[model samples]
Target chain A: MNAFVQLDLTPLLIGVLAAIACALPGNFLLLRRQALIGDAISHVVLPGIVVAFLVTGTITTWPMMLGAGGAAIVAVVLIEAVRRLGRIEPGAAMGVVFTAMFAAGVLLLEQTDTSGVHIDVEHALYGSLESLIWLSADGWGSLLDPVALAGLPPELPRMAAAAALIALLTGVFWRPLKLSTFDEGFAATLGLPVAAISLGLVVAAAVAAVAAFDAVGSIIVIAMFICPPAAARLMTNRLERQVAWSVAFATLSAVLGYVLAGWGPLWLGGTHAVSAAGMIATVSGVILALACLLGPHRARVGAAREA
Target chain B: MDTGFWQAFLAALALQAGYNSALVAVGAGLLGAAAGAGGTFLFLRKRALVSDAVAHATLPGIGIAFILMVMLGGEGRSLPGLLLGSAVSATVGLFLVEWIARRTRLPEDAAIGAVLSVFFGFGIVLLTVIQTMSSGRQAGLESFLLGSTAGMLYADAVTIAVGGALCVGVVLLLRRPMTIVSFDPDWAAASGVSVRGVDLAIMGLVMAVTVIGLKIVGLILVVALLIIPPVTARFWTERTERVVWIAGALGGAAGYLGAALSASAPDLPTGPLIVLVSFGLFMLSLLLAPVRGVAAALWRHRRFQHDVHRRQGLLALARREAIFDRLTLKVLRREGLIRPDGVETPDGAAQAAKVLRDEKRWDVARRVYRDETIAGRYDGLTSIEAVLTRDEIAELDRRLGPPVSVGPRIAGAVP
Candidate 1:
């Protein structure tokens, strides 16, 4: 495509891939009745980063990912332990563990040496969608080997990975996940190890969250996890249908967010390109708002007419 | 630890005093506790997380307030203006959440979550715009995200404390009506409790708490203080009065501790500290409280099981005939249900027998046997049938009283 069109395509591509990555894991979370666990793990993973930085003296993605994933596991375990102790409800356990872990993470981050960290806080917030422009379709793997197409975009692999992950999850555990999500006790009665399935979903969510964190900042990561599936859930009860709608919504939002951020500048009078992550979030928000308005359940309208 | 640290610590204290920190902290804590107490009822009703949505909605109100401040040529960062703006927006948010849940097929949790995130996003957008347009006049808006009690003044405390007290006092005054509405609104309505009025009052109370609490616990932790304490306190007592008092105490303690800890350290965020401390207290209460406490319950249940096992063992080993352990065996006794001797004495035995015969076990047996009757019909008359004889029935009645009046007995029934 032309440079004009290509500029718009970058963010949208990232947004779509990010959204897909986020939404795929989110569907399982929503199904497993641990939708908020994503929110919890996102906060808890901070201490992981701090611990990683303190030990390794670096801010590489791999170390951060390991730290975050470990912390997420700790949070998951804490929630389960608290619930099994029988005093705290699952939600309360989740709320307590995540908040405590988040607070601890913040405290740790405060003490860490920031000098060696190449990425500044603002850069972290802005993200590096610009990096997506030069990478090849096969990604950085080919870059180290001096592949001829090293200069191409890397969106294809990212999108492909997200699609593959979603397919694998849906294919292997679709029936069991749906059964457990709808009724855990019944699923247990059916001899399903609901706990194992739930833990598996949480791990998948953590991996997806870490993967997408590069595309979208931590804040938007939550919006992506919650918004698309949430909006899809509003219109449908069928789990398969909800997943379909979620992917469709994510794709549309990503494409639209990319285009808007890219071109809104030429028409809208702003010099800075609209942020890809911000635009995607805004699109998700818009879609949800529209759904709320158009959805059959307007209490006021229904109440008034009924009365 | 060092002179510099001490200096920083002292400076922090000075700033706190300069802003009337003690008064505000106490006021907010008291108000937060009261509101938290009121929150307990809602928690029991399983609507604890709704407050989180209300808290999130307050952000847009702050944004609007800042805009209004700009329009009115006042400092947008002023506490009163911010508080007022948040209250209005948070109230709207609460109503919208309820409306959405009621009107749509969305579950309450989803509705709350959806509203909270969306409103928060809108708030962010507003904040981003204000920052860009006003050249950072709205810098203070970010502090509200996590809360900043560092700048709390006497007036802020007084407003929240007094308002919170009034709301809580009203809740106490209407406790009877409120409880009735919560547990059984239909029955309460029949008894002249205005369910609608009670609901309105409670919602209004929740709103007041949310507004005042925004300063101390901020948006996110506000729900924690409201929910965690009440839930934690629930483990301590079955009595509503005790639960409220304990929850209030726990919440107040959390607020106070949070303030002190934040004050002790210069860089720490007060809101997170308060929530963290509150969670600690909640966990402790959940584990160790008297009746409902998890550990306590487990202890009681274990002891109870041991006693039961011992009693059962004693009975089984009794004289091998119709004997029982003596009344003073101590371990073999349970109130009402068991005696020292495993077998009841004539009087106690009669009472126990009466209760046993009252059960419809024979009727159940008859039903079970009827289905099998066509196959053989108890050719030798099943052993259980012998227990149902007229003579045995007469003897049982003489020993005990007549069996509890159920339906008429059938002669030569299936058994």
Candidate 2:
């Protein structure tokens, strides 16, 4: 009973919030054909986090977020520059910039004296989701009590704020985003600030990424950014329904993945839980795979139905 | 800075002194060349990022192969066994990308991203399982993620060498068919080349190279080895054959130098260093390569614009007076096209006659040709140096009779 009470729910809540936040802006990226920008930004943020840690001598929230946001902007700019200047394909350009940035992050981490810091290089790569715990909880009721809310992990509120920000931004810019994504030339002809809207989307993705990085890490964040939105895209051609489906899929994966990570090992006769973040990513992937194989709107299924 | 460091660096560089490093370097170099050559076709086909998906997909195979080997009570890290597993998984990944693109409404980029992230996620799950296993030997499997060449044995090097050689051999044997398919699969198919067969062959070669490259550069950075060299080579040449050869050379050099440097500095990982080195080479090629490089192209464009302006100035002067502009005359004299006294030398007479003839043709074309035809021929007229065919000149003559004397009449102008 005590173990159950002591069991923290923050990780699950944070995962859900982060997953939803990532998926919201991720739909625009998918429609824009920039689905992999999330992957690129995830990698490029490592150096940002590490540099922030190095500069501030602490792994605080704002600095890391600021650093990551700055890094994301730099990554977008650099990717654009490489694409335009080298006349290289966007994917290859992205591959070059992100890999180099990630390499630089690794090298920097190795060089810096970060022994005393709570965040290590391994933590940056795979994340430290296991460490997130709320020990002050006495029972499930305490989680609902405002008194016990102070005991909640800071990552929860951080992720919640980020989710709100992303949701707000997506709502505000929904029309321009949809217009530009569907037809950039038309949007430009209409004198819509297509470039600004696109940059705003990138910035929104960056914020969600930074917010999620503390809880789920970059790999899972990247998976969330593409897999749910992509699966949703398969399920529907309509953008509104797609966004709803993406959020639902993301939430489903988060809850199910967290449960599986915590309890699946016990079912399999192991004494310990696996990585919740990795499990989340794996679940989203499984959902995407299933969607690919069995979605009603999938071309294979549609073809079979017609036949 | 110290003698010990200097000695170690020298020993690292001297292949004879460090046999293990030499073997690893040679193996990596061979892998690099094979990937580079194979990657040229992939790049030309505009499927460069497919290699990324293929590379990430190999991780799960390695994990699965290790688990199977452990379950079978054999050593899980057997080179051939692991590589075979990697090859199968990479091929499946390639097939999935193709399948998704073909059977679904999703674009190729989304398909690739889906496969890459999902496969990697599954691999991480498998890795987590491997970590939880009671077996202690599973520790070495993590090296496949980031790559570590320090532990490569001579047998491992030989395996890479043999595999790389086979991939290169296949690429060389089928270069012509591969080029045809890459450039124009429809035409290749129409011309009796089995486009499907060639595509499968190239995909097979990419899978082989990617799997073999996994040990040296790891999964994440292996695609860089496949892409950067070929992309850099593209900045230097337009011919597929030259691109392939240059890409191979650049990949080999990057792999060789990167391995040597990493061997000297044991702290740095070989995979990222190799990528960084190749990236450096790519940057240099992007900036400095002769034809398509940014700097060279910019200079050529500027020079072309300057020539256009000079020719326009000369035409303006010739239109106003029988003599050339002073600046044009100075340039022409420097090129031995004119005398210092501003009279047309034989070469100058030919150039001036050509320019005057172009000006007269412009006037005749304006009156005789319709606006649409003149617009169609606008590029030719603006170039001024375009050599008109005899038929075109005769057609112009028939329409306008002799060339109109619009510009200052040169003595030896073509009539």
Best by DockQ: 2
Off by over 4 Å in 1: A1-11, A28-34, A54-57, A84-89, A111-163, A182-191, A234-238, A258-279, A295-307, B1-20, B151-174, B308-415
CA lDDT of every candidate: 0.66, 0.81
As a TM-score, model 1 comes out at 0.75
Summarize candidate 2's per-residue lDDT along A1-307 as a digit string, tens digits. 5455566477778889989999999998988888889988888888898889888889788898998889889989988987887888888788778877776776677668777877654466557666677787888888678877788788889989999989998888888888999999999999999988889889989999888987778877888899899899889988999999999999999899889988999998987787777788889988988998888677844666664
* Tens-digit lDDT track of model 2 for B164-251: 8887788889999999999899999999999999989988888898888888888877888888888889888888888899998998
Clashing pairs in 1: A12-A258, A135-A152, B324-B342, B325-B341, B325-B342, B327-B340
Best candidate, lDDT-wise? 2
Off by over 4 Å in 2: A1-6, A118-121, A141-151, A300-307, B1-11, B308-361, B369-385, B388-415
Best by TM-score: 2
Kindly state the fnat score of candidate 1. 0.15
Q: Give a tens-digit lDDT track for model 1, residues B192-254.
A: 988888887777777778877777667756777777787777777777777778887888777
Q: What is the lDDT of candidate 2?
A: 0.81
